[model samples]
Target: MYILGIETSCDETSIAIVKDGEEIIENLIFSQIETHKIFGGVVPEVASRLHMEVLNKIFKLAMEKSNLSLKDIDLISVTQGPGLVGALWIGITFAKTLAYALKKPLVGVNHLVGHIFANFLRKDPPNFPFISLVVSGGHTEWILVEDYDRYRLLGKTLDDAAGEAFDKVARLLGLGYPGGPAIEKAAEKGRLIFDFPKIKCERELDISFSGLKTSMLYLIKNLQKEGREIPINDLAFSFQYRVIEELLERSFIALNKFQTSTLVLAGGVVANKYLQKRFSEVSKRENIKLFMPPPILCTDNAAMIASAGYYLYNKGKVDGLDLSADPSLEIF
Candidate 1:
């Protein structure tokens, strides 16, 4: 079956076509990083407008690249929730129009779960009952995946998501928008000199970053007041270290506690080199198989949605024309 997936969950406008969900025929993404960079964050209205402008163009390109026409598409899948409602509206509306005209099944995919399923596209797939760490701009979660469409949420962020903290901190430091890459780059030149607090939560799997973000703010302000030249790179390095430290600690604890042998990493933060390197180290020492998609699949894209669509469809999941966008949809 050929599934055409459209994703406008955030600042990215993407479209992709996949064959049976595993083989990506063609995936295309139009990034709004430059536009949002000026603002140092995403503006919902701007994102929705950009989606409207480029959605059709990319949709055409994806089809042309795949050498397939609308008639060849067997199913239409779209990210329906857990994103900007305006952005989600654009993709779901487009998918709905296509489904109506083509008389095909439309599947609504959970954006977060779609990340976990991205692993299926990789050659070295992990076995069932694996531990998945999905850290993103709006979400940070450690979930236990027992099988297809079966997710047991083990833990999640108590406050701001990891990606959100990165952006907020980067902005505070003038590191730039899309904080993950900016901070990561700056962190290279510096060392983890600052002793950022490592917060602990009552729940073993639960993690908190709100305090961490606040601590960085206090440190930066105090250094400025004291006339100490802020070591920007060093601060970035230390902050990144603290965030990743919390993530690894919680994830490793979960893995051992659950007795899961496979570790799967997903979401946009998975692209961070430092985090990935650290995860690689732990996976090696623990002798657990780890599945991480290439950067292309790591971030939000239509291919992952298509992969998820295929699985959701098989699970007898189908959306009606009445299906609408949901910004805060949860994965059950």
Candidate 2:
């Protein structure tokens, strides 16, 4: 079966054609990085407007690249929630119209679920009953995947997500947008000298990064007061170190508690090479299978939406004409 997916959950306007949720025929993503970089972050109004402008062209391109006509698609899926509402409405509206016109089933997918399924985009996919960590710009979560559509929420962030923390800290250091990559680059030239707080909560599963972000801010201010030049690289390294250490610590705990044999990492934060290396070492020593998508798939994309959609489609899940965007949509 062929699945057509559209994702405009945030700054990225993407579409994809997946065959049986296993093969990606074509995945087209139009990232607004350059446009949003100057602003140091994504502007919802600008993002929605940009999506309105380029969506149709992107649709045509996705169809053209996939070499498949609308009629050839068996179903249509669009990310419908847990994102900027305005940005999501554009894709949801377009997808609803397209599905109606094509006379195909339409499914609205949860954005976080889409991230977890991104693992399927890989060649050697991990088996079920795996520990899934989805750390992104907007969210940080741990899920126990029992099957394609069955999941159990293990833990999630209590405040800012890992990726969001990265961006905020990067901005404080005068780094550009997309903080994860910029911070990683700076850390490479420096060493972790400062000790940032390690997040801990009574509920071992819950995570926090807001305190870590504040610590960095205060650290910089104190340096300025001392008439000392702030070491941007060292600060970046220390900041990234604390963030990754928290993630690793929590992840290991979850793995042991859940008794899962595979660890599946998803979301934009996985793009950090340092994080990957740490996970790689753990995977080898702990003898746990590590499933991480290529960097391209690690970030937002429609293929992951399509992959998750395929599972929902099989479960007889369908949305009606009244379907609308749900920005606070929760994934269990």
Candidate 3:
């Protein structure tokens, strides 16, 4: 089956064609990182406008690169929500129009679920009943995946997500935008000297990062008040360490509580080499099967959406032309 996927959930304008959810015939992505870097974050209106401008070009390129015609696509998949509302609408509208024009089956996929399914693209994908730690710029969630369509929300961030905290902290330290990569890069040359407070959630599974971000702010202010030169790399390393440690601690708790042997790391934050290395080390020590997609698949893309849509479509999950963009859509 050929599935054409559209993803404009945030700053990326992506279009992809996937075969059987496993083979990616062509995946094209146009990143707006450079455009958003000046602002130190994404502007919803700008992101939406860029998506509109480049979406058609990306779609055509995907088709051309794959050497496939519109008629060859059997299903249309799109990221429907939990993202910038304007950005979500652009992809949803384009997808709805294409599905309507082609009379193809349409599936509006949850962006987070699409992240989880990115693992399916891996040659050695994890089996059913796995624990997924989804950490990204906009979200931090723990999910229990019993099957392709069966997902239970195990826990989530109560305030700022891990990626949001990273961005906020990075900005505080004069680091550039898209904080995960920036912090990771700075952390490479530093040591974990600063002792940032760790996060403690009221609920066992729920997590919070607002407190951690606040702590970092206070620390920086105190250092500045003392007329001391801030150790940017050390601060970055310490902050990243605390953040990754919290995630790892929670993931271990979830694995034990749910009795799941396999652990899947999803979303853009998983692209951080430090996080990946730590998770690899711990998962091996604890004898847990860990699965993570490559950096290309970790970020917002259409291939994962297409891969997810293939399974959702087969399970009789289809949407009508009236499908609307849901910015706050949740994966269940």
* Structural similarity to truth (TM-score) of each candidate: 0.97, 0.97, 0.98
How would you encode candidate 2's per-residue C-alpha lDDT over 162-213 as one tens digit per residue? 9999999999998878899999999999897998878877689899888888
lDDT of 1 by residue, 1-332 (tens): 99998999999899989888788898898999899888778899999999999999999888888888889999999999899999999999999999999999999999998888788875556788999999989889999998878899999998889999999899889888888999999999999798887688999889888888888889989999999998999999999999998898888888899998888899999999999999899889989888888888989899999989998899889999999999999887
Which 10-residue window in model 1 sums to the lowest lDDT?
A: 117-126
**Model 3, runs deviating above 4 Å:** none
Model 2 score (lDDT) = 0.90
After TM-score superposition, what is the CA distance of residue 315 in candidate 2 from its true location, in Å? 2.1
Q: Name the best candidate (by lDDT).
A: 3
Model 1 C-alpha RMSD to native: 1.1
Candidate achieving higher lDDT, 1 or 3: 3
Error of 2 at 49 (Å): 0.8
Better of 1 and 3 by TM-score: 3
User: Which residue pairs show backbone clashes in model 1?
Assistant: none
lDDT of 3 by residue, 29-132 (tens): 99998999888789999998999899999998888888888899999999998899999999999999999999988999999999999999856678999999
Candidate 2 all-Cα RMSD: 1.2
Descending-TM-score candidate ranking: 3, 1, 2
| Candidate 3, residue 47: how far the Cα is off, in Å | 1.0
